[model samples]
Target: MKLIVNAIPFAGLETGITRYVRCLYQALGAELGVQVGYLGYHGLQPTMPQAADPDLWSRQTKRFWGLPQPLIAAINATQRLRLERLLRAGCRSVQPRIYHETDLIPPPRLPLPRVYTIHDLSLVNHRHLHPKERLWLFDLFFERRIRQVDHVITVSEFVRREIIRDLGLEPRRVTAIHEAPSARFFPRPAAEVGAMRRRMELPEDYILFVGTQEPRKNLPLLIRALALVKQPTALVLAGWSGWGDQAWRQLLEPLRLEQRVYTTGYVDEETLADLYSGARVTVYPSLYEGFGLPVLEAMACGSPVIAARAASLPEVAGDAAWLVDPQDPRDLAEALQGLLADPERRRDFAEAGKKRAARFSWQRCARETLRVFERVAARKQARRS
Candidate 1:
């Protein structure tokens, strides 16, 4: 079957969504009977030869927006017109059995079956989000997109439930496909781990937390917990700081734990894998998640995971990691301390986590996703017939 994938997000800096889309494309591309074409502006100028290059699609899309507004708007209009022209160009080129909008944005109302992947309801659920963001979510995007699409795919059951509850849609219309950590997240050798640590200037022994420093991550509670821990262990906060950088700084300032609290803005995948392998433990005490990718990644890397018992986390972590009440700093602290104090427990968790992580793979996700596509296409075809 012919497939048209909205791969616009892949052109931008790598994000969770971009990674998801790229991996899905690669996994599905090799299958026996499928043809996939990406539909979106390349981040380059219309006049440039690169604009027509499929490999440069992402870059061209970015550059399109970088142009002056009037020029950009005119170019965008032309692009849209061209897309319609191209879509109508031929039955062969246009008769895609499946149209997948990988990003949240729905494609123009199309004749073919359409599928949308809803990563999270964060814009609707996040209390700390800006008003404009809330407005865009509630008033502008998701509700209408959900109604228009033939099927919705979410990352986790938690998100699926949230979508059904919030949007009053039938649960059957949404499929929950659990995400997988990259293959690179698996255990690295000790010597390579040491080299990574030296490269990143990471402490010999540290407790790692990946994800943004947003209020939703409940980082302050983790910071408070760290204060209470008596061990010589340091806390490494990776990922870009989210909403609470000032508060995070204030919390860590007077504790004289600057040496103990390391904030690496963002590390590359190689260093990240090393950091994960070498960490005493990886803690993810978030208040919410659609699916906790970091927990899975840590587990896959053979890092003992300490995660919150809230939202989709417990479901993601299962019996592989330490589950704690994210709201209680004391409980988190005790859990961290307990894990650190016991070598046997860490080893058990580490070994179990690796095994658990092995069960999830992009191949499985791709197969499930293909099923959803087929289901949606069949439903659409039936309606037409």
Candidate 2:
């Protein structure tokens, strides 16, 4: 049976769900040997920003906020409605056996089988971190659309439980599938690593944190931890900026970490591999996570990782990373110091991490996800008979 997977995220940022959808779709068609049709944006026309658009929140927010905000929302909603109507017509014509929306945004309700991947309920569970208007948009457009789907796929068991709890769906209807780092993430050669270090002007010995700059990431606490570390290690922030008060930037001046903290903004995949490979310790102290992709990617590149033990991070990190309390900078500082001061432990972690990372693969994620689609398709077929 043929499947239609949304490829809308291919147009926007390379972080979070866009990366997840792009990697998952590539594997589904190429590795799983599934007959798939590409739908939504790219090669054709306009589509909503995929996964988490770094600019989505600001685009919706007006400087003053009372009248212009609502006016803009009304106009944008009208445009989106027209585009979605055309998209629904296109999907009806293709009439694929299954339609999977990898991006969290749900599609227009269809008669055919439908599957949606819900990365997390962070916005609902941790509402303070997100803007008010952003939450309203979800409730207005995509909240009910989630209930209209045939089944739901979650990235981690933690998220799967959240979906069943928050959405009040039958446990059987939701499934948790693990995500993996790409083949390009493996340890790079010395020559390649050296070239990337020089090109990016990155320090040979530094700590790394990869993710958007948002309140949920808890970057300010990380900066405090960096200041406390006895070792002279620079901290690198990779990925694009997202919504949230970046007053964290002001802390740099007072803390005297301005010279030591660096940002690569957004780097290409090959450069990402080099960045991960060169770090002395990769730190991810986010307050929450759907699935910690950076933890897996750093492990794949043989970088020793220190991640928050909360949520799905421990599940993804397993025994590979040094887990820390995301709230306490002192705890984080101690962990960083220990890892940096000890070379043998770092060596041991590097060896074990590569092996741990091998357990997850995009091909495997594709296979399991296809099984969900096949099960739904089979049920539909039996009913028609």
lDDT of each: 0.76, 0.81
Could you report the Cα RMSD, in angstroms, for every candidate shown?
5.3, 3.5
Off by over 4 Å in 1: 43-93, 130-138
- The TM-score, computed over Cα atoms with residue i paired to residue i, of candidate 1 is 0.85
Report, for all candidates in order, the number of backbone clashes: 9, 0
Model 1: per-residue Cα lDDT over 302-334, one tens digit each: 999999998899888899989999889889989
Clashing pairs in 2: none
TM-score of each: 0.85, 0.90
lDDT of 2 by residue, 1-385 (tens): 5777676555456777777877787787677767666665332222223443435533543232545556655654665566566557666666678878775466677767889888888877988877665566666777678778889999999999898888888999999999999778988888898898898888888899998888999998899999899888999998766656376787899999899989987676788899899889899999999998999999999999999979999999999899999999999999999999999999888888999999998888988998999998898789989
Q: List the residue pairs that clash in candidate 1.
A: 11-58, 42-60, 42-61, 43-59, 43-60, 43-61, 43-62, 43-63, 44-60
Shift in Å, residue 206, candidate 2: 0.7
